[model samples]
Structures are given as C-alpha cells and as structure tokens.
Target: MVVNNGIANDARVIKTAAALRRAGAEVTVLGIATAGGPREETTAGGVRYVRLPVFPRRGATAAYLRFALARRAAHLVRDPRRWQRTLPSLRWYQRAFTRELRALDPDIVHAHDIHLLDTVARTWPPHRCPFVIYDAHEYVADLAVAGRRTRREVESWAAKERDRISDADAVITVSPEIATRLAAEHHLPRRPTVVLNAPVRFDGPADPGAPAGPVRSLRAEVGVSASTPLAVYGGALSTARGLGTVIEALPLVPDLHLAIVAVPYPHPMSQELRELATSLGVADRTHLIEPVAAHEVPAFLASADIGVSAILGTAASYDMAMPNKLFEFLHAGLRIVTS
Candidate 1:
C-alpha cells in the first residue's frame, strides 16, 4: 500500500493494513516520512512501514524546487504548450518518487490517493502491470476546487484521476456518494466500492456510565468549572473543518467553553485560531490541546458535554463525508453538532 501522508496517524490506512494482515496477506505500507520520524519501521500488526524521505534534511532548496516543479506540472497539464518548461522539473520529482516505489516489487500495489497514482503508474511496467487498487480517500478534484487551487489545476488533477482510474484493476472510495460520482465522472466499466470509514467495533459490554475521575481532572486542568458546558473539536485546525466558525460561536454562547484537540499535522491555522479567540475575547474559555493517542481520544470526548464536527460544505467531498470523528463522538456518547 502507498500513501502520500505520514502513516503514523492515518487511522483508515492503519485499519485497512491490519485487516489485510489478518486476512493472511503480508502488508507493507510505503508513505512519506515526517520530520524527526524513522525512515522505516515495522508495526506490531506485522505490517512493514517504509517512509520515503521527500523533504530535505537541512536545506530548503530541494523542497522549494519540488514545490515549484509540482505547480509547473499542474499548469502544464492544463495547457500542454508549457510542457517544454515543466517536463524537466516534473521528471526530477517523478524519478525520485518512482525510484523508491520500484524497490518494493510487490504483486499488488494499493495506492491510497490520486496524488500517488502517477508515481505508481510510472514505476510499474505497462505490459506486466501489477494489480492496482485505487483507494481514493476523497474526491480530491472537488477538494482542490474548494481550496485556493485554480480551475486549471483542478481540471488537470481531474484529467489525471480519470486516466489513472481507467487503468486501475479496481477502484475503492470512502463513501457511496463519492463512488457513484467517481464512476459517472470517469465513465468507468465498474463502479467504485464504498467502504465507509466506520469506527472500530468493540465486542465488550457497553460502558456502565461516564467515569468521574478523568473528567474531573481534565476539567480542572483546563480551568473549566464542572457546571460549564464544554464542547470538543478533535481534528485538523483548518478553515475547511469549520473550526473558525466554532470559535466565533464561543463568544455568542457565553456559557460554553471549547476544547480544540488539534490534529497531528503542523498547521499554520493554530495561530489564526488563537488570534481569533483573543479578538473575540473567548481565549480564556477556549483550550487548545495537542493530539493524543487514538485509544485516549474516547476519554477526552467523554469529558466534554458535546462534540463538534462543524465541517464546512465548501466541497462535494466534505459535504457528503461521513467523517470517522462523527461516529467517534457518538461512540463516546457526546451529543454532536455538525455544520
């Protein structure tokens, strides 16, 4: 399996890897290594994780060049006339990515996103192609359309996705809505399979009730009185996630305090959130916490009076997404408020 993101906190990929391992398949996950993380490691589940070093060790030259090349490629894809200018840079990045992927030599290559498809395709031989499973986690084209990406970039990405899907042995998506849309968009021979991002199931008995020990301590640490109504948002601190809206609401809802558990990725929005909270005069009531282990998330949710998803409907992907965090809140018995 291959993915673009660091695999440490990718719940869906980890779950899929574990399931595949349990089904008696030897699984190896190839992903980009995060700063300060090991380049390679094997998990307890018997899945080998090999992280490709995409970023430079000390200098920013390589990283900047790669970014510039990616942008050039995007532009060239939209207007092929620019291929002469973009090809060299694009080839540099492609060669690096393909070099690492080719070392794996597996029977099947499961690509986790559209971004990795080009590299995966280029690495494997055309006549003797490995079984490729395009596991699209979201409608990336729509997502780019919703962001700062230009229409040309979006079209370029969409075209690439269509071409790759045509060659894929099978396609998999996170939701039925996405699957249907992808099928129609690409005019694929088969509809993509919908594998919902459901929360992991537990066979044990239901919780008797909320425990007071953790709740009481957590509240004290955050200076949230027992009587105060606390709402928790545990995910990326991005505008797309509607975290800004939640911060805006805090001033209006005088009695409520928001505990934001920022997702693992290094986010610039953390500063923005802090500024917004201070401006709104809700800084004292808002608590920003670092991300915790997956098993520890339930305890944090249980401590809150409510769980907030509030994801913006800027893109089709976000609009139709049945986010795992939503079910996580439900499983933890927190009342949900979604946008």
Candidate 2:
C-alpha cells in the first residue's frame, strides 16, 4: 500500500508512485480522488488510487461541526482544524485501507504520515508479512503545543506514534528537525532516514506550454489590476498556517495583489481570515478564491510575482514544515519570502 497523508499534494505522491511502479512494485494511493465524489481505480501508471469515503467538506464552519459530531468524545486528538477538509475521513478510511492492504498482500507497506503510522502500528496484524515504513509529513502534536494546551494531548499522541516508531522497519521524515526530535524522544536504534521535501530533479527542461488564461482572469474579476505585483498562497487556509502573516505582508507591499486560493479547512480561522483581510483595509487587494486542481496550480502560480509562505514559530509542526506549496512555488519559478 502506498499511502499519502494529505490530498493537497497529490502530484508528488502520484509521481513517486509511478516511479515505484517502474522499479517493479504495485502501488495503491489512499486519499480523495478528486474535488467531487470519492472514487478509486488504477492510475495512469498502473498504480491503484483509492479514495476513501469521507464526510463532505463544504467550508470551515460546516466541516468543524461535522468532525466534532463524529468525534464527540476523544482524548488527546489534535485539533481537526489543522487538516484540510478535502482529506478523507480517517475513521471511515481505516477499514477500507486495511481490507485492501491485506488483499494486496504486498512485500511492504509505506505510509505518508504520523496518522497512518498510528493507524498501522495499532492494527496491521502480525500474520501479515508487510513490513511498515512511515514518513513523517509534519509533527501534528505541535499544533496543540502551540496553543499552550495540556501536553497530555501531545504526549498521548506521541506515545501512540512511538508504538509505530518501535515496530516500523524504516522511518523517513521531511526535515532534519523532525528526525532529530523523534530520534531523541524514541531512543531509535539508529537515525531515521531524512528526505528533503523537493521536486524530483528532471533530466531535461519541461516543454513550454501556454500559461492559464482563465485563472489569470480571476485576478481581473477580483478587481486586481494586471500591473499590480501579485503575491499569492494556495492550498488550504488554516489557523496554524499563519495566514495573518500573509495578510500583514500585504500592507508592506502596498499596491500588491494578494490572491489566497484556500481549500476549505475545518478551522474557524478560515472565515476569520476573510474578516481580518477586510478589516485590514486590504480586502480590495486580497482575492479570496476557492481551491484549484493540482494540475492547474502551476498556471496560477505562474501568473504571480512572489509566493508568500509565513507561519508562526510557536507550533513545532509549522516550524518543521516544508509544505509542497513551497516547492511548487519554486518549481513555478516564484521567489519565496518567509517570516
């Protein structure tokens, strides 16, 4: 089973799965299939892509209510707020994921995040011959740490994660900081594998194609003049992402157009960001837009002069994060400004 923790960054996972297949392994990706109803089947490269059944992700408010209702009484769970609404429900997904993994009966199972790490550590039966490998996408417990909540929450989650850490044949992480912390905390036998979050180095330059015209027209629709220096951020709009930094950066570069193409997250701050942008008197310059497909992201990023990626240092997860958008912006040839 080839598991990707999040839907916002599927292109990288898809590309990775394709390469794995070329090297001789049947791979199955677990997550949402598209923006519409969830579906599953083989991908272009013969790697199976399975979309788990999930609660519909409408917007910030609705998604929070849904998650809260679904998990009314939970201990030591991170704020569902940190996740993107488009992510398939983990609760509903676990069963289907297990069923398929067993059916596949692969030589190995590689998962993309701590959530999957926790899931497999607890459930993957001993009889199954699959040796598990986990990739730490982000340190989720750090979200609660930032809020100054009881470390009990983080500790509990970390303990479950340790269960995975002890058993996994291999552990890979996106950053050195994450690898260091996990190593220190768990008393790992040896250092975990560290893979920097970067696009695969292509052997040759990409063939030229025309830039997107419709997404470009979106700037005009929002009354953002074409001449204005466009500063943009994509992916889900969430609390921990520190979009306030994005908004605050707006006034610093006045006359700059800020395009926020936010996927609906189950965080209340998504709406608060809209209000904050409006109150900051930068509403006219700020274009709050809906999420776009992965293939279309380059076109949107291509039209921009700079990409804004700012997150507070308080959250360990945020501090350690190397989001796909950061790399995507670079791949799109945008300059990065971080705070």
Candidate 3:
C-alpha cells in the first residue's frame, strides 16, 4: 500500500493493511517519513512500514541544491500551483518510492490517493503491471482551488486521474458521492466501490475478564467537570474546518465548553483560534488538546457531551464527504452537532 504520509496516524491505511494481512497477504506500507519519525519500522500488526525521506541524506551538491529549492518552495512560495510545480521533493519521493516498490515486487499494489498515482505508474507500466487498486480518498478535482492557476493545478491532477483510472484493476473511494463524481468526470466504465471511512467495529476486549486500560477523556484533558457541556472537534485545525464559527458560537452558548483535539498543537491556526476565543470572551471555555493516537480517539472523545463537525462548504470535497471524525464520534457515543 502506498500513501504519502507516515502510516502512524492514518487509521484507514493501518486498518486496510491489517485486513490484507489477515487475509494471508503480506502488506507493506510505503510513505514519506514525518518529522522525527523512524524511516523504517513495523506496525504492531506485523506490516512492514518504510518511509523515505523527502530529501536525500547523501548525494551530490546538485541534489542538496534541489533539496534547498524544495524547502524554499515549501516555506517562501505562497502560490499552491507554483509550490507543487516547482517542488522536486514529490519527484524525488516518487523515484525512491518506485525503487522500494521494485525491490518488494508485490503481486498486488494498492495505491492510496491521487498523489501516489505517478509513483505506481512508474513502478509498473500499465500493460505489464501487477494487479493494482486505486483508493481515491477524495475527489481530487473537486478540492478547493482559489484562482485560475490553482484550478490548473487541480486540472493537472484530474488529467492524471483520468489517464490512470482505466489502468487500475479496481477503484475504491470513501464516499458514494465521490464515486459518482469520479465515474461521471472520468467517463469510467463503472463507479468505484464505496468504502466509508468507518471505524472497525470490534466487540469488547479479547479477554472479557481482563481489566480495561485507563481510558483517555476529553473532559479530563480540558479539566472540565462532568456537568460542563463540552463540545469536541477532533480533526485538522484549518479555516475550512469552520472552527472559528464554532468559537464565535461559544459566546452565544456561554455554558458550553469547546475542546479541539487536533495535531500540531502549537499551530498558527491554533493561535488564531485562541485569539478568536479570547476576543469573543470565551477563552476560558475553549480548550485545545494535542491529538491522541488513532486507536484511542473514540474512547478519548467519549467523555465529551457532543462531537462537532463544523465543516464549511468551502470545497466540493467538503460538501460531499463523510469525514472519519464523524464515525469516530458515533463510535464514541457522543451527540453530533454539525454546521
């Protein structure tokens, strides 16, 4: 399975790999190493995980120069199109990914998301390739695009998807809406299989008599009492997430406390949210907790009174999507409050 991000927090990838492994197939998840993560490791489920660095560790001066350029593209460049077009890191990762794939030479290759299409295509030329499954995590073409240039960037991805969709032995996606759009837009022979981003439903612990581990709680983390009406938002801390709106509404519901459990805790957006909360005079009620592990998410969120999906319809993907957090909230048994 090929995904761009480190496999540590990617619940879908981990679950899929585990399922494939249980079915007697050896699974290896190839991805790019996240900040401070090990390049090579194995998951508890016994799946091999290899994460290649975006930049080469030992290479010629030109390679390092290209790495510098990529870093510049990431930090200095404001235009998304220019960032994507000029960045060499994607191609560098592609070459490294293709090399690892060649070494493994698995019978079946499952490429996750549109970003890894080129990597898979390079590894196995269409006609001669092994069985490949394309997992469309989102409607790439329908993603939020700001200007004409960014639209062109999305168009390039659409073109790539259009070209490669036919080559995939099977295509699966996160939602039926995305599946329908993919078929209609790409002129596919058949709609992709719909696989909702639902959590794996297991009964209780394997040993029913065994003591349960201490469950993390949003209320406990936020230092909120059992009676405090805590609303939890667990996902990316971004403008499109409509968290600002949620913060704004907090002033109206003076008694309700808002807890955001997200990654990259000290993020610019996190600061922005803090400022927003302070400005609205609800700072005391707003809490931002660092993200917990994927396995602990449901139990962690279970202590909250409500799960909030304050997604603003800023993009087509957001409009017709079933976010993983929604299912997690359901599993946690939290009452849902959406935008």
Candidate 4:
C-alpha cells in the first residue's frame, strides 16, 4: 500500500515505487490518478497505481496557472467556505482510496501520514494486510491548526495519528526527532524506523545548458540586473517553513534580489510576507516564480546566491527535515543558509 500516491510533486512515493519495481519487487501505488499518469494504469516498471478519489489534484500542467493575475495564489486556506467545500471532496478521496487498496491485496500495506492511518487500519482485515507501516511524514499531532479549526479537531486528528502509529506492524518516520517522539508518545510494541527524507543522489548530466549567458538572460528577464546578487528561496511558503525570516533577511542586503520559486502554501501568512517585503521597500526586487518539479530544481537553484530552508524546530520534523530543496541547492553548487 503506497499511502502517499497522491501527487506528482510527491517525488518520494513515485521514486520509491519505481525503485522497488526495479529491485524486482512489484509495487502498486494507491493514490490519486491524474491525467498525467500512465493511461494503462500500470507502468512497465512493475509498478501499478490505484487512484484514490480523495486525491484529485491538478498535476504540474495545471500548476502553471496556480499563481496568476495581479494576485498570485492564496498561500493558505483561511476562509470558512473553503473547509465546507473541501469536506465532500475528502469523502470522495477516502472512498476511492479504500476501494482501490482493498482490491490491490498488497502483502505489506504502508500508509503515509497520520490522516491515512485510521482509514488504512479500518480497511485492513484482521490478520490480513499482515504488515501495516505508518509512515509519519510530519507530526500531525503537534501541528498547530491554522485559522478556524478547534482544539477538538486537532485532538481528533492527533488521536488518529497516535492510533495509527501505535497499531501498525511498524511505524516509520522521516527523522530521529519524530522517531524519538513517537517512541515516547505511543504504546508501540517496538521502535519505529527513521528514514530521513534526503534527496536522491543526483547522477544526471551535469550543467544542462544552464550557462553564464542563459543565467544572465534569466536575470535580465526577472529584472535582476547585472549588479544584483540573488538570494533564492524555493519550496512551500507555509508558516512552518519560516519564510518570513527570509523576507526579513532581505533588508540587510542592498545589492540583492530575492527570487522565490515556489507555489505558496495556502495561508494568510504568505500574503503577509509579500506585504512585509513591500513594506521593507524590497518588493521591487522580489521575483516570484511558480513551483517547479523536483527534477527541474537544479535549474531553479542555479539563479541563486544562497538557498534557504527554515523549518522552525518541529519535533515531527524527522531528523532536521532534509527537504530536497536544501539538497538541490547543494547539487546546484550554490551556498545555502537555513534556520
């Protein structure tokens, strides 16, 4: 059971599934099936994908228009109506998710995150689905819900996460921090495995046409003139990511332009960040680009002086939360500053 077969940008699942198949294991993805996925439903890689209804998201192509108009996309879903509208879609995703997994009859089922734990647990027949692994991507339990949800809502989600981690044959998390916390917080029979979310070691062709002339051309296109240094921040602009710090850091450097290449995670804080940049009089130097794919990251990182990854010390952050953006920065041979 590939619990996180949800998004194309979810490169971990995709790569893992492919890797498993290449290693002589048959893999099936229980995820949202977008138009971009192989139409045959199963890839030649011995990997099959089962589209979960709840995971209906527009893929990279649809991502093109995410930030448009005088306004870019909203970074957070702060409105009440959005939640009401989102509930029905959630139900569909659940139903589609359960049916497909049940049909797949995987020997070992792995659910990626606390939200899916209960659903997977209920779906698994007693003594069947022999191995259930609760893969905690982040600490759902510790997440401070934003905008409107009550403490009860958070408690319910956290409880479910706890149950999932406790009940699974094995609990797997991305970092030691989450692993240690899970060990202390739950009644798991044994310790959960900690698999750090490191970036794939790049073995691709070096310098894929990203040279000086093209780099300068990109600089010119984004209004970053020859004299300016570029401080690039890539990836989600969520509250947890600590993007405000990046904006605040901008005021210290007069000869720099801030290039943010990310689809702002839905939040009011993101809008506020933009406003903060404007208030600081650095808004003119802000170059906002939409999200790029995992593979295309080096190209994005190429136009930067330093890459920033600021995840304010969440325990759920398994082992320093080695987000690939940090790795991409390293791969692109750019300097990086993180918090």
TM-score of each: 0.82, 0.73, 0.85, 0.71
Going through the candidates in the order shown, the clash numbers are 0, 0, 0, 10
Candidate 1 lDDT (Cα, 0 to 1) = 0.71
How far residue 228's Cα lies from its native spot in candidate 4, in Å, is 3.9
Q: What tens digits encode model 2's per-residue C-alpha lDDT throughout 1-339?
A: 455334434555655665677678877777644423565554543666777644445446765576666654453345533332222355645654666666666777777765566456546566654688877666755753544344655555555575556668888887788888888888887778877656544332221242333245445545656687887887655555678878866777788888777665334455677788888888778777665545456555776788887766876777887777787788778888776
Which pairs of residues clash in candidate 2, taking residues 3 or more apart in a chain or in different chains? none
Assess the local accuracy of residue 4 in candidate 2 as a C-alpha lDDT between 0 and 100.
37
> In candidate 2, how many Å is residue 175 off?
0.9
Please give the distance, in angstroms, between residue 191's alpha carbon in candidate 1 and its true position after superposition: 2.0
- What RMSD value applies to candidate 4? 8.4
Considering TM-score, which of the candidate structures 1 and 4 is the better prediction for this target? Answer: 1
List the global CA lDDT of all models: 0.71, 0.63, 0.77, 0.60
Question: Which candidate achieves the best lDDT against the true structure?
Answer: 3
When summed lDDT is taken over every stretch of 10 residues in candidate 2, the lowest stretch is 204-213
Candidate ranking under lDDT, highest first, comes to 3, 1, 2, 4
lDDT value, candidate 4, whole model: 0.60
lDDT at position 41, candidate 1: 60
lDDT of 3 by residue, 268-297 (tens): 577788888999999999998877656567
**Where does candidate 1 stray beyond 4 Å?**
34-44, 57-93, 144-148, 202-226
**Clashing residue pairs in candidate 4 (N, C-alpha, C atoms within 3 angstroms):** 31-52, 53-93, 54-93, 75-265, 75-266, 75-267, 76-266, 76-267, 175-318, 175-319
Question: For residues 1-339, could you state the per-residue lDDT of candidate 1 as single tens digits?
Answer: 888777877767876776677679988888877643456665544678777666444345766666665655555544633432333333533645677667767888888877677677778679767888998888866763534655555455565676667767899998888888988888888899988765544232112242322333345556767788988887655667888889999878999988887767445677788899999999988887766544345655776889999887877878767776876788778999988
